[model samples]
Structure formats: C-alpha cells, structure tokens
Target: MTLFRQIYSLLFGLFLVVVMSLAYVQFTETQSFLSKQMESDLNNTSNSLGIMLVPDLEAGDIVGAETLINVIFEGGYYQQVKLTWLVDGKQQVWENDLKIDGVPQWFIDLGFFKTIKRESTITSGWIQLANLEITAHPGFGYHELWRSLTNAIIMISILFLIAIMLARFGLTWILKPLHDIAEHATDIAHRKFGPDMALPKTSELKSVVSAFNSMSHQLKQIFSSLDEEVSELRKKNLVDQVSALPNRQYMMGRLNSWLGEPNNGSLMMAKFDWLEDVHGKYGYQVRDETIRLLSEKMKEQLDEIAPSVIARIAAYEFAFLITSGEQEVCSKYLHTLIRTVNQEISKAGCKPNEQFYIGIAQRTDDMNVSQILAQTDNALQKAIADDKVFHWFESNEKQLYTREQWREHLSSAIKNKNFQFKWQPVYLTERDEIIQRELYCKLEIAGKEIHAGQFMPYVELLSLGSLLDRCLIETIADSGLLDRNHEPVAINLTFHSLSDKKFHEWLNHFLRNHRWAKRIVFDIPEAGVYSDPESCEALCHIIRDNGAHFGIDHFGRQFGSMAYLQTLRPSYVKLDQSFAFYDESEHSSELCRALVNVARGLDIQIIVTGIQEQPQLARFEPLKTNAYMGFIYPPEPVE
Candidate 1:
C-alpha cells in the first residue's frame, strides 16, 4: 500500500481500540454505581420500616403489624416484603411480591444486577417481636446502566469519525512536499534541471528539497561543460585547423545532406594558379601563408551570405556551398568574390596578371554530389583552356521547362489540388512485414504526371512548400488509407513547413480533429532538424502531443555530433543511401556503428534505406538495422 493508505489504516485501528476501551470502562463504572445505590436505599428503607412496625408488635397487635406490612407491600416499590412473629418457638409470617412493568427479561438477564434485600429485628423492650424484611427490584438500575452504555457508544463513534478525517487531512498536508520532490526528480531525468521553487515547512523535508535543488544545479553545470567539450571536439574533427573552415569530409557531408532535400543551391570552386610557383620559390611557408590569407579573404566576402559549407579541399583549391535561392544572385556574389581575392593577392606581393581560375555550378534536382563536383571541375578546365577568370557550367540539354513555366505549372497544380500520392512500403528487416508506407507526392499536368524532384524546386522557390504539405496531409486523411491498412503512413515535411509557425498551428489544429492522427508519421530531413534545433524540438512536442510520430530522414549524411538526438528524441532515423552503399568500407562501418550505438542508447530505431542489392543488404546484418526500405521491397500499387 502507499504511505498515505498505510497511515490511514493504522490510525483507524488505533481509534477503534481507544473507543472500545473507553466504552467498556464507562459501562463497568455505571454498573458499579447503580449496584451500590440500590443496596444503600434498600438498607435504609428496611431499618425505618422495622422501627415503625415495632410499636404494633409490642402492643400484642399482630393484626396491626400484618396491616402495616400489607400497606408497605401495596406501595409496589419492593419485589418482596415479609413480617414474622415468634411465640413459644412458633413463627407466623406475612409476605407479598411486587412486579415491575416495562422491563424485558433479556435486558435484566444481560445486566445481571443482584437483587438488594435487608432484614431487621423488632421488639417491645429487649426481646424481638418480629422480623421485618424488605427487598428491592434491580429493573430500574439495569435500565439506567443500559441507557448510559448506549449513549457512550454513540458519542465515541462520532469522535472516531472526526479523528479519521483529521488524520487524512494531516497526512495529505504533510506529504505534499514529497510529491513536489518526486516531480522535480522526474523533470531532472528528462534533462530539465532546475531548483524547485516551493519551500516546504517541514524541517526534514525542507532539507531534502534544498539538497536536491543543489544537486540539480551542479548537474546542469556539468552537462553544459560536457556539451561545450563535445562541440569543440566535433569542430576539431570536421574543421580544417589551418584555415579554420570546414574540411573536405565535412563539405561532403553537407553536400550529401543538401542533395537529399528538395531545394536548390549553388557550388563554387576556386583554384590558385601561383601556389606552386610560390612554393617552389619561397618554400612551403610562403605558400601556406598565401593560402591562409586567401581563406581569410573568402570568409570576409562570403560569410555574410552564410554559405552552408566553405572548405579547403586541396592545397591550392577551395570550394563554397551557397544556398542563395537564385542562380543570378549566386553568380553576382561569386564574381564579386573573385575580384576581391584578386585585389587581395596583388596587394600581398603576387603578380598582377596571375589570378585564380573559378568554376560555378548550380545544383539541379537530378544531380548527385559527385556529378555536381565533376561539372564544376569540367568548367574549371574550360576556364583554364580559354584563360578566363571564371566559367559557369552549361548544360547541353533540358529535361524540364524554364523557371517561369514551372512556376505557372506548380501554382496551377496546388490551386487545383491536382496531385496524386503513391505508397512505398518500408519493412521490418527481421520479420519482413510492412511497418509503414512512405507517401510520395506527384503533380498531374495536362495528362502527364511529374514526380516531386521535377517540381519541388519551384514549389519551394515560390514559398508554397507548407501549402504542399497541407494538401498532402488532407489527401491522406480523406483517402482512408490508415483505416484500411492499419499501419502508419509517413509524409515528408520540408524545412520551410517545419520552421513556419502558421503551419505548425494549422497542423496542430488539423490533427486534433483527425481520427487517424496516431497512425501518421511526419518524416523531417536530418538537415531540417539541425538547422534550428529549438524550433524542431518545440514542433516535436506538438506532434507527439497530438499522438503522431516524427522521425529523421537521410540521417547518416550529417557529419556533426548526434547530440541533438538527446533533445529531439525522434522515433526513428533513416540512414541515407551513402551509408548503405559504402557499408563495406571500414570507415563507413565504424561510423555506422557509432550512429547505431547512440541511437540505441536513446531507444531510437535505425532504418536502412536504398537496399537495392543483396550484397548491400548483407553488409547491414552485422549492424543490426531495425528496418529496410527501397527497391528491394518495391511498393505494391494501390487500386
């Protein structure tokens, strides 16, 4: 039993014992007093009667004595009365019995009062003439004792109830401090450390609460220090110590993450032409100094735009990943950056004619990181051949219409709700059972359908990403897919949508009214999660409160620390195709193991995506991935 109940029971038992003892003592006292009062009254009445009857007996009036005895007996106060005379050793006796009414035999038997009887000798002078006897009925005494006992019982019962109420109130009042302490402890476990504002009045409990508050404060400081250390370590591993910029590995991770999302960005590659000559003439020290100066100049020009990644990938080459939204603006910024670097180099004692060759490539929906980098490198080679300052990679063919045309098409599709959703099954690897179906959105255009990659860029560019998310949510809700399949349906949410406050409010209200909210899973890209962790954490709380699940897609591409997982606690993380393809390599395998260990520590599931070939799938067995997705388990078409 709980502490409160145990205390209540003990107090109640003690109250019962006390009341019973008091009632028994009261019963015995009343019985003894009534018995003594009856005996004393009988003795006094007998003595007085004997004196009055002696006159009659001394006058030799036996008849008068008998008359007096009958008169006293007729009063009906005594159970029995007797008068006797002695002459010549013979005795004559006069006796009568008195019965009282309204007293039950059982009550009298239970009361068990002894009858009071008294006798006195009467004579004219010295000799005894007759003996006078008197007896008193115990019915009245028994009735008084019984009444006193019943009253005592009723009074004690009331007191017992009052005492019970007092005990309950007292226990609850005293234990309120304990409840607050427990709640504080629970919040601390969730990493929300703070002192309880409440101060208890009880000395012992107050001391305990004060100690707990102190401990929480110390823990918070320790955790903050640990986070700082971890962040510094991560920086050391992913940053170029010489340039204080992201390293090549970090750049690749960022590029991979960007490619996984439905957005448009640009990449710039700059190569120094004089670095080799400088190294040959002044040794490696002068070359390193020039590189550092160039890195600083790059940061001064591009840092304002907040490029996603800037890295010195080679001794003489630096790459920039900018998400400036427009190709024209990106080109303008790059031209300006090139001019600034040329001036800075000329001022630093380099030849005026010698300049860095630059190559710029606009990211496309269909291009991978390697392909994009190749295009930039190809453009750089052309720049070198023509002796141009910079050259933009030109595409030979077009698979889609121009920007204006896409804008018009996507706008019309969203306005007309002309989109279809296709379900792609993700299965549990161990059981080979469908755990969820990932929903892919397709826009229908003039009897033709285009996938997300073909039109999402324009959708995001127009700031209609949230609108698309809403339409997809409503379509799934109306389709009854959840009701029919009895499994969760995963839908993608863009960074634009997650960061939009209005979208979050609308989603909360929408899910509140939707009956199948619990069966819905919102898949947010890992890039979106780390972009704004505070907002993402708030959104996660909202989603979970509404009975929906949230997870990270394209998880392994981000080379940063997994510390965010400790806060967001996403339900699952889907490994990007890069991890699955490179699973055989030792470096990739160790990274995957680290990710798995961290995720498992937080009870988060790991789902490997892009498991197309048997060899790739076999490599994941040792990692013990929780689920699988991709062409290996192609989705069955829904009628």
Candidate 2:
C-alpha cells in the first residue's frame, strides 16, 4: 500500500482501540460502585433493627415481646427479622413459618435468605434472639445496575461512531496533497511536463514541491539546448560551397535510404561546362550565388511533376533521384528539369555563360544505391563527351552495343584521349569583349562532327565521366592554348570528377605546377554545386589554394534554395536564360528585376545570355545585367 493508505489505517486502528478502552473502563467502574452501595445498605438495615429489638427484650416483657414478634411477623415486615426471648430461665424462639407447610425443603434451601442474630440481658437470665434470613428479590438494585450498564454501552457505541466519522474526515483532509502529488507523478511518467508545482500550504509537502519544480526546469533547459545544437548542425552540415546544395555524404545517405524502398526509381545527373572560368573571373561568391539561384529555379520548375531529391553530388555536377516506374516519365522530367535549370542559369548574369550536361539512370531493386550512382556518373561522362546538355542511361543495341561493348569502348577512349574539345564564346554586349567561353567535347567517328546526344549515353553507361573529364583536362593543358593572358577558359566537371580522389588530386597538382593554370576556370553546374555545397566549398578552397577560381554554371534551379547561396558565397550569378528570354512577360521581367536587385544588394554580378535583340538587351539593362550573349555574338569556330 502507499504511504497515505498506511497512515490512514494506523490512525483508524488507534481510534478503535481508544473507543473500546473507554467503553471497558466506564462499564467496569460503574458495576463495582453499584455492588458496594448494595452491601452498605444491607449492613445499615440490619443494625437499625437490632437497636429496636434490644430494648423490648431488656424490659422482661416476654409476653409483650412475643406478641410484638407475632404482630411483626404477621405484617410480613419482619419476614427477615425473627424475635425470640427467654421465658422462666428457658430459651423460647418466636418464628413465623408461613411457607413451611407448602414449600419444599429443596426450595427452602435454594431460595434467597437473610440471617441475623441478637442477644439481650433480662432480669435473672441471658437471652439470645435470631432473625429470619431472607433473600432480596431481583428488583430495584438489579434495575439500577442494568440501567447503568445499558447507558454505558449506549455511550460507548456513540463514541465509536463519532470516532470513526472523525477519523475518515481527518484522513481525507490530510491526504489531499498526497493525491495531487500522485497525479503529477503519473503525468511526469508519461512524459508530460505539466503541473510543475502546485503543492499545498502544509509544511510537509513544500520541500517535495520545490524539488519537483527544480528538476523540471533543468530538464526543459537541457532539451532546449539540445534542440538548438541539432538545428545548427543541420544547417552547417550537408552543404557544398560552390553549388550550395547537399554534399556527397548527405546525398549518398539520402540515395541509400531512397533505394532501400521497394519501389524502383531513376537518377538524373547534370554536369555543366565553363563553371571554373566563370568562377575565376567572377569569384566564388558570385558562382555560389548563381548555383543557389539555379537550384531554386529547378525545384520550382519540377514541383508539379514528381517529388525529387536534388543534391550537389560533385563540383560541376548534380544528381536527381526521381521516383517513377517508367523510364520515360523520369526522362521527360529530367529533360524539363535540365531545361529549367539551364534557363535559370542564363538569367543569373554570370561573367562567363554557364552550360550543363545531364545524365539520367533509373534505379532498380536489384541495384544498390552505389551501383545506381555509378551509372549516373557514367552517363555524365558520356553527356560531356557527346557535348550534349543531357543523356539518359537507357541504350539500344547497334552493331556491337552490349553493356560490355560500351565499357570496352569507354576504356579505349579514356586511354587514347578519343574525346575532342570545342569552345563557345559568350560576349559582353556592353564592352563587345569576350568575357567567358564555354568548353565542349566531341567524339571522333570517321571525321564526322557527331553530336553529344548520339553516343554520349553509351559513355555514361560505361561509368567513365570522370575518366573522360580527366582525359579532357590533360588534353586541354597539353594544347598550349591555356597560356592566353586575357581569355580564361571554363571546362565542365562531373559529379564523378569530385568523387574521384585521383582526378581532383591530379588537378590540384597540375594547377600548382602549370604556369598558365590560373587562367583555367572550372565551372560547375548549378545542380552539382547545390547537391553537395560542402564538397564544392572544399573544392573552392583547393582551387583558391592553387590560384584558380571556382564558378557555378547553371544559376537557378532548386526548391526553396537560399540554403546554398548564403553559405558558399560565390563570385557571380549566370542568369538562367529561360527567365531572361521568356518573351519579356511582365511577371518574368519582374522576377528578373527582383533577382538582379537582390544580387546587386549582395555586391555580386549578374550575367544574362540568349539575347537575340536590342529589346531583350534593353529589358535586361534596367535589371543591371553585367553582360549579354546570343545571335548578336556569333559562336567562335575552332581552327
């Protein structure tokens, strides 16, 4: 039992004992007092009779005494008093024997009797007198004793009832605070922090109440501190510096979790070109800002289609893990996403025009998350080699196009530097100077200028985007064209490139040794930068250490994505062209104006591309666009 119950029971037991003891004491005392009173009355009555009888015997009136005795005996008043006198020196006894004739000897012996003896001196003789013994009838004294006992019993019963009622009332009042404490304790056990302290004014409960309040306050403080730390960590972690998106670690964790599901899905990786040159000219702040903008745009664009997980998986690349059974749905969504991201990139107003190449691979239950990521990586290389904006993982059989066949072809290409590079100039419309150039690569096939869309899918299927990137880097450095003083070249990197420790390490080494490496600008796509912002930030540090600048290509494309821009702090934003070139709609122009104003407030430059006319240029000028390109600046051909 609880403490309250035990106390109540103990108190009740003491009350019962007290009530019963009082009853016993009162009853026993009354009985003894009445018995003594009866004995005293009996002694006094016998003595008074002896005095009256002695005078009559001394007067020697034997006849008179005998007559008196007869009279008293006949009146029944002397039933217990017998008179006897000496007559003629002989003993004579006078007695009334009324019941002797009718009463049985046994009854006479058993019935109540009172006996008394008296002696008197007469002239010439000593006489002895005896009084009859009589039993007192069970009448007045019996009634008095019974009445006293009955009254004592009644009083005791009343006392017992009163005592019980009082005990119950008192216990209830005393235990009220205990009940409250119990309720509060139960609530606390269930994880409810309610009713911190509302103890009664009783002195006994005050200390417990104070202790409870102190403990609760401490618990609340601890939890609050923990929550703050967790929030800070979440914001700080899982971000890339260049793209200002979730880093590779966070992305991989997310991908692994997504693939754990039974449902099959697809991943689309976007790799962009000329990000480094843009970063080198514009700076890291502008590049990261452009990436942040692009991420937001992509998220907005793809909001209606499917739930997507977009993250910066590498320096110049991003990966989208899209949930869909059909590859076409993923493909269509991927295209829309790539298109929107590229469009946003052109509007952000970077110094160098930013471009992207995307690779998509669908997920299967049979494939682990690592395997699927590998496929996206492979696809990214193919997209870069083919010089296409995007490519899908699905491939069809040609002459010798099995899975193994493509892998072999990719192995050979990587070993032989089979990929070729091209440059697209982005002109500064106001200055008429070539401020940035976008790099491209093509595969040689019988002297044909084969587009990236044709055979890039196979390269991606072979998981060689990093190898191709490595080969392209070595080839560009070997070409001797990087020594130009005023012209900085931007080349694309893939998510695979960032993951490839050898590739980044090699680039770092190359930048440290090469005399003209500072002119080489590495531009990462918006998706890549945002997917793993931390990695990009790390990459930025690496490049900065080597005297090369980091730039983000596709400017805007992600969901509610201010998270990246605030952290990475890139050099310039390359405005996505879709918003800039959206037929000059009022909402689109307003958005452009707002973005330019925001970028200007941050002291970052904004570059808009795809400008075909004076009106477009005029529309953008008010928005403080730093530069422009399009049909007005013809694409420079390679010699």
Candidate 3:
C-alpha cells in the first residue's frame, strides 16, 4: 500500500476507537444520572402520598387512601403505585399499574436504566397506617440515552470523514519530496546528469536529495573525462599529428571497409612533385609550412563536398576518398580540389614550378586495396612522364554534363516541381508495426531519375540544401498522405535548413496552420544537430510546440558528448548504417552498447538502419532496438 493509504487507515482506526470510547463514557454517565433522577422522583412521590393516605386511613376512610393511590397511578408517570393498610392485624393493599409507551423493548433491555422502587410508612398521630410503595419505569431514561447515542454516532462519523481527508492531504504533502527524488534517480539511471535543485524541508529527504545530486554531478564529470580520453586515444592512433588528418593506416582501414560495400567511391592520390625542389630552395621549414598549408587548403575545399574523407598517407602523397557518387562526379570534385590547391599555392607566393601531380582511380568490384594503389601509382607515373599535373587511371567514364550544366539541371528540377518522394517504412522491431514512413527526395530530369548521392553533393555545392528540404516538406504535406493514414512521415533536413531562420519561421507557420502537422517528423542528422546545438534546440522546441516530433538520423557517429540530448530530448535516434555493417570488434560493440544505454536512459527509442538480411536484424535483437529500416524492408516506391 502507498504511504498515504497506510496513514489514512491508521488515522481512521484511531478515530473509530476515539468515537467508540466517547460513546461508552457518555452512555454510562447518562444511565447513572437517569437512575439517580428516577430514584429521587419516586422517593419524593411516595413520601408525599403516604402523608395524604395517613389522614384518610386515620379517619377510617380506607377508600380515600385507595382513591389517592389510584389517582397517582393513573397519572402514567409511575409503573406501579401501592398503599397497604392494617385492619384487625391483617394487611389490606391498594395497587395500580401504569402503561409504559413510546420506548422499544430493546432500548430497555440494553440496561441504560434499571427499574427503581421507593417506599414510605404512612402514620396518623404517631401511628403507622399503611406503607406506600412506588416503582418508576425507565422508558424515558432509555429514550434519552438512545437519542444521545445516535447523535454522538452521527457527529463522530462526520468528524471521522473530515479527519480522514485531512490525513490524506497531509501525508501526500509530506511525501511529495520523495516522489521528486525517485524521478531524479530514474533520470540518473538513464545517463541524464542533470541535478535536482529541489530542497525538501524535511531534513532526511533533503540530505538524500543532496547526496543524489552530488553523485550525478560526479558521474557526469567521470563520463566526460573518459570520453575525452577515448577520443584522444583514437586521434593519436589514427590521425597524423602534423596535418591533423587521418594517417595511412586509418585511410587504408576505411578504404578496405568501404570496398566491401556496393556503392564505393573514387580514390585520388595527390603527390607534390616539387617537394625536393622546395626543400632545396626554401629549406625544411618552408617545406613543412607548404605541406601544412596544402593540407589546410585541401580540408577547406573538401568541406564543400562533404561526406568525403582526406588522409595524408605518405610524406608527399595525400589520398582523397569521394564517396558522394559515381566516378564522373568524383572526377569533377577532384578537378575542383586540384584547381583550388594550385590557386592557394600561387596566392602564397610559391613558384609556379612548385606543382602537384594528381592520380585518380575509381573504386571497382574487382579491385582490392593493392590493385587500387597500384593503379593510382601507375597513373601518377604516367602523369610524371608526360609532365601533366593531373591524369585518371584507365579513364573511361563519360561525364553527362559540366558543373554549370548540372547546376542548371538541379535548379530547373526544383523550380518545375519535378521531384518525387519515396516512402520507406520504419518498423517497430518487436511487433513489426510501421511507426513512420521516411520520405526520400528524388529528382526526375529529362525522364531520368537522379539518385540522392548524385544530386545531394551538388545541392550542397550550390547552397540549395534548404530549398530541397523545404520542397520535400511541402510535397509531403500537399500529398495528404499523413492526413489519409493518420500516421507520421519523417523528412530529412540538412544543417543549412535547420539553421535557416526563415526556414524555421516558415515551418512553424506551416505546422500551426495544418491540422495534420503533428504527423510530420523532422529527421535531422546527428552531425547537423551537434553543429549548432542552440539552433537545433530552438527548432526542436518549435517542432514540439506544434505537436510534431523530431529525431536524430545517422546517430552514434559524432565524437562529442551526448549531453545535448538532455536539452533536445528527441523522440528517437536512428543508428548510422555503418553500425550494422562494421565487423563487431570489442571496442565497437562496447561503444555501440554505451550509446544504446545512453539513449535508452533518456527514454529515446533506437532504430537500427540498413539491416539488409535476417542476420543483420538478429544482431540488433540483443540490443533491444525499437525499430529497423533498410534494404531488408525496401521503401515502397511512390509514383
């Protein structure tokens, strides 16, 4: 039982006991008073009657004495009245019985009052004439006692109810702090380190809450420290200290893993041909400075073509992995990087002779790491022999359009509303219930459906990310699918859109006006959310206020603290597809488990993405993932 109930019951029992005790005492006192009053009344009546009877008896009028007794008995106050006389040494008696009414037998039997008889000797001139006897009925006393007992019971019952209510309220008020403490403990269990600032008035509970807050703060600091250490260790092992880029080992590992997938990207090798000349002319310091500057420029250029990885593999060679799309698209990005690097070197007052040799090789199903490196090396040798700055190994892929042509195609597609949405069902893993349909935006240009990978990179390059996101939202809302099914649909929004104040205002207005807005979920990338947490949090608040939900996609990839989760409090988190494919190493599994636990603690649901087979799905069962989405449950194509 709850504490309130226990206290109420105890209070109720005590009230009953008090009421009964008061009733017993009052009953006894009323019975005693009635008994004494009855006796006194009877005694006085008998004495007075005897004196009157004596006069009649002395005058030799026995009939007068009998008449007096009969009159008194007929008054109905006494149960019995008698007058006894002596004639020639024989006793003569006159008696009458009065009817008792308006009192129940049970009340009389309850012994509230007992019958009392009083007697007096009648005398005339110092001679005893007759003995007068009177018996009093307790019906009146019984009636009085019964009425008082009933009133006492009724009054006590009301007080009992009032007491019970008061006790219940008092207990609840006293125990409320305990409830807050329990909730704080629950939050801590979920890895939420927010402290409870409540200070209960009760000394014990206040102490307990204080201790709990201290423990949570300490745990937060410890986890933060451990995370920093782990991140530093990862960087030390895989990153090049000088350029702050992934080293050769890390690049090779990433490339080997990417090769196992079907949609691999192109790898470009940039070798500085004038490294020896720079060292000879400008000394080692200039040489190192040039390399650092080149690496920084490469990083800056790669930012435009994100989802790309660059690593300094050798002293003079840096490898670039462009996984955005096909070989043709990768070639365009490579050419952009080469031109940007040459411009930076020239702007830095470096000699025009200080050139870089670029070799590009497209990833193929038949090629391994060694083959890829050999092919790129062969291309580099050819470039060197021909004194060319850039060359592609076994170049055979055809480019559909120039950068300007691709840009125009995308702009026209958006303006003409030539994009279609495909719906992929994200299902609850345990019950196979479809919770939401994730919408993928596709562009149809000249009756050819352009894939996301082919278009998104260019979309980012042209600053059309917010436009695409807006189009997708408007398309989904206008289709009425959310209203028809009364189910939610998730639309992906890039960082640009999330940070766009105008987009946020527009979305807020749209949601407020649309009745089906609650069925729309904005799925933001984890990287985007972390990029500007304040903006993300603000947008999340707007979404929540409109009764819409927000989720994090590509989760568990960021190398930062998850404390932002406490503020954003997303409805769910979709695990990155890489988590499903990577070989389960101890470290990877532990990290995955930690992330899962953290999300679970925050009451956020985990949806594993890219489960292409039963084995992949089975791998996540032990983790108790809430949902799954991937090729295994391919999206239903919408025309």
* Residues 229-253, model 3: lDDT tens digits: 5466546655777677877766775
What is the alpha-carbon lDDT for the whole of candidate 1? 0.76
Model 1: residue 251 alpha-carbon error in angstroms: 3.8
Please list the Cα RMSD from the true structure of every candidate, rounded to 1 decimal place: 6.7, 27.1, 8.2
TM-score of each: 0.73, 0.44, 0.61
Residue-level error in angstroms, candidate 3, position 351: 3.4
How much is the lDDT of residue 77 in candidate 2? 26
Candidate 1: misplaced stretches above 4 Å?
15-238, 253-257, 275-307, 343-347, 351-353, 397-412, 556-561, 576-578, 581-585, 634-639
For model 2 the TM-score comes to: 0.44
Which parts of model 3 have CA positions greater than 4 angstroms off? 45-177, 196-226, 246-349, 356-523, 532-551, 565-572, 578-629, 632-639
Best-performing candidate as measured by TM-score: 1
Local lDDT at 168 for model 1: 77
> Which parts of model 2 are misplaced by more than 4 Å?
36-195, 223-245, 272-283, 293-308, 323-343, 350-354, 386-389, 395-639
Clashing pairs in 3: 190-601
RMSD of 1: 6.7
